[model samples]
Target: MIEFSEVSIAYQGTPVLREVSLHIGEGELALAVGRTGSGKSTLLGAVNGLVPHFTGGRLVGRVTVAGRDTRTHRPRELAATVGVVGQDPVAGFVTDSVEEELAYGMEQLGVTAAAMRKRVEETMDLLGIAELRDRPLRALSGGQQQRVAIGAVLAAGPRVLVLDEPTSALDPGAAEEVLAAVTRLVHDLGITVLIAEHRLERVLQYADRVLTVHDGRVSAAEPAQAMRSAPIAPPVVALGRLAGWDPLPLSVRDARRRAPELRAELPGAPVPAPIEPGAETLTCRDVVVRYGGTVAVREVSLSVAAGETVALMGRNGSGKSSLLWALQGSGPRHSGAVTIRGTDPAGRKPVPRRMLAALVPQSPADLLYLQTVGEELATDRAGEILDELAPGIDPDSHPRDLSEGQRLALALAVQLAAEPAVLLLDEPTRGLDYPGKHRLTALVRAFPGAVLIATHDVEFAAETCDRAVVLADGEVVADGPTADVVTSSPLFAPQVAKILGGGWLTVGQVAGALR
Candidate 1:
């Protein structure tokens, strides 16, 4: 259903994809895997004519989808056959409510009203989003917005779907829902699907074929064959490699079946010493954050000590983001108080807010407005800070031109320039690869003050956080050591913990015990 013939693409003379050739069959789900800025997005864009046509790049050779040449057809012309959902769902929204968003695509295609309504309901039910039909798009959580975006495209009844990091913002359960829906489309409907995701573990099990994009080239193979040497892999694959397991396991269940021998080989190891948390650096007492009549955060109390890293994890719309905003003194706090370094942030005057805390919102791009990276770094006289946080980024490149990971690094550099006592990051690893996530982990470890991160990435939290705090329905559900909190919950457990079942939270911990 999709074919790329000697496709070489460039942007302003710089080649992004070079002589790539691949074919995706009808009813096949192909996964694109690669490190950050490794042409994954560029390759996906070529499928629907977004690369050279809408993105102002040069395309050589041919890309055909459903027997139509992308070179000869614009994105709008191919919309009936190819549906594309980008990484940022909110940016693609064109309607006020979920139902309207789903109908808007069919309306553009001039689909009959009766047909549109039928497809809308079917798409909503398919994705398990029927309950959110009337909710305004603006009030939905990041995960909800992502689901609506997918539903909008599915309602159009396209022959092929191209999704870019479709499950990045979703929690484990919600991600499973989205992936199940995609699997149903590929099997039950015979629709071709192409997905690019950084969290390989979540999607690899659902993919029939894997496409690895690296060094301006693309290669196709089955998941097992591709993962053997793929630069980006999930923790289960990494564990299999480290333990010398043959035919590396792709899912947690497979890994668990092979875990007994490895567990017996390695002796019980002591848990590493926890970080010595210093005196209270930030404290929240009965923080009640509400929006109109909706209680987003309900009388939640928490505290973070100096030199501590705490992860705030929960389901989508569990008030994790709301609590973070309230603690930053930027969002509504119907009741309760927040104090940073013994001074209430809402009442402080002499000391600047930046000095007290710095928050990197879920959408890092929203905090950036400058034309170039150099201009963004110059705002706070942050030459030294940029050099420290992100050393290799080109200062002259446009911020929009950078990759998702690079953009996130730039945002971190800009925020860290303040040298605040408390640092808050919301979904910091959304688009980062393993290496990028490691670098972020190192940066977080180097910070001297307290840190609070709100994320759904269990592996990232297991690697970097010292403690875990879970919220449900706007209330704290669990708060304890990171290993204990994550390993005890099936929904939040990392692959290593799920497989080994010995309170191990990450591969690093297991490797250390083996050594």
Candidate 2:
């Protein structure tokens, strides 16, 4: 029930979307796919009249949602017909508790108190957030916050829903839960859903239609037809293309049915050589971090050797983020000892923090404070550094104006310019497409130091890391080579491993074996 007719949008004489024409029928789940800074968000904003109205841009042509023209109606006026959930859930929160946040949208729409209460509970049960009714919004984990955000929008009872990178910060299981709930909404309630996501593997299975945005142009087609030539696709689709499978499979179950012949073609494929870690660069002993009565991290001891890349993977709220912060020496540690190059990071030494380690948190905007990319680069003398890390970013664009992937690249460039001995990144591929993720993999491989990354991206870990350290309930449960850890665990295995039933972790490896 969303329509865009001859829509061309520009900001300060720069074109973002050009003459885009498309229609999304009611009850259809449409997926938007593209690279970073490719106008996905801009198109989503135009649905609720936020592009030219709140964002201060120039809009030409028309955008209508549920037969209401967005050009004539403001976002508030169209609130009853459309609901939007952005990338950052914390930024959109206006209340303190989960129950309150869910009810806030209904109250804003001037619904009766009884109706608001009923919808809040129904939405909570629908999204499986009933246990977190009284929890504070700020204290919840990223995945829990995401559930609350979606529940809030669904409680509004709108005809259409627009979500931007809805599951970027969630673990595999949690992502499945969120997508299942959205699918139920489209099928059970006939509510149209439009999602812009980079992790196509997780959401493509549930989408009825696909929309591809590339080089400022938008095209729509059936999911199978669109994925055949789409610029970005999941690993299973890539594998199907490489093996010449007809009617490419979108899920692991379908791929496995057709994988036997391909598996027999390449009998004994060789695994890539693993990286050998050098001398110890970082060490921690009995690290414990607590928040009031809750122990986020228990007595955990870990070490990272020089020239090693270790991926710290676990479910949501599994203490991965807490452990990373504790090791950084900037966050709270109730009782622990962390040493960097044989020196305590929290000691009275004169060395700067940047020299020891640099952390890129989940929210990259927290580390960016400058107005524009040009000024931030000038402050750190990182013009050449950013170019080497992630090129083709506009210097005059505001840091907030950049897309999620571009913002992440800028934050990484700013941190890598310091040349730290150790690097820590949390959910680095949150909004990055395949190309952006490839560039990040290359950059991480080229870094000359020990690196520890806390992430839920299984594909990325398989492609870049040499080792995997998995934590559960604030304790280390599994730690070994990447292949051994990922292949042995069902929850953390990549698509290729699930389909081929071997140790194949990526499509590139299968292609190598066939060649």
The local distance difference test score of each candidate is 0.89, 0.89
Candidate 1, residue 221: the lDDT equals: 97
Per-residue CA lDDT of model 2 for 320-427, tens digit only, reads 998888887777899979998987766433247767888899989888999999877764546766675567888988898888888888888888878888999999
Evaluated at residue 97, the lDDT of candidate 2 is: 98
lDDT of model 2, residue 493: 96
lDDT of 2: 0.89
lDDT of 1 by residue, 1-515 (tens): 99999999998888889999999999999999998888899998999998888888899999999999998998999999999999989999998999999999999999999999899989988888899999999988767788788789888989999999998888888888778888988999999999999999899988899999988999999998899999988999999999998898999989999999988977675476658988899999999988888889999999999899999999999999999888887778889989999877775442487689888888888778999999998765466655554566678889898877778888888888778899999999988888788888988988888999999999999999999999999999999999889988999998888888877878888788888
Candidate of highest TM-score: 2
Model 2: CA > 4 A from native: 347-351, 379-381
Clashes of each: 0, 0
Error of 2 at 182 (Å): 0.5
